[model samples]
Target: MIELGKYAGTVLAAYGVSLALLAGLVWQSIVANARARRDLERQEKNG
Candidate 1:
C-alpha cells in the first residue's frame, strides 16, 4: 500500500466512495437486465 501518512484518511475515503459507486452500478445493471428479460419473455408469450 502507498504510504499517505497524514493523508491516509483522504485516500481511504476516496477508495470507499469509489467502491460504493461501483457496487451501485453493478446492482442497478442486474436489476435492469432481469426486468428487461422478464418483459421480453412476457411479450413473447402474449404475442
Candidate 2:
C-alpha cells in the first residue's frame, strides 16, 4: 500500500466503518423485500 504514514489507522478505520454500513443496508433491504413478498402472497391466497 502507499505510505499513509501517520494517517494510516484513521483511514483504515473509516473504510471499515463505511463497508459495515453498506453491508447493513443491503441486508435490511433484502429482508424487507422478502417480508413484503410473503405478505402479498398471503393476501392473494385469502382473496
Candidate 2 lDDT score at position 34: 100
Residue pairs that clash (backbone atoms under 3 angstroms), model 2: none
> Which regions of candidate 2 are displaced past 4 Å?
none
Q: Where's the lowest-lDDT run of ten residues in candidate 2?
A: 1-10
For 1-47, candidate 1 gives per-residue lDDT tens digits of 88999999999999999999999999999999999999999999999
Per-residue C-alpha lDDT of model 2 across residues 9-45, encoded as one tens digit per residue: 9999999999999999999999999999999999999
Which parts of model 1 are misplaced by more than 4 Å? none
lDDT of each: 0.99, 0.98
Model 1 quality (TM-score):
0.92
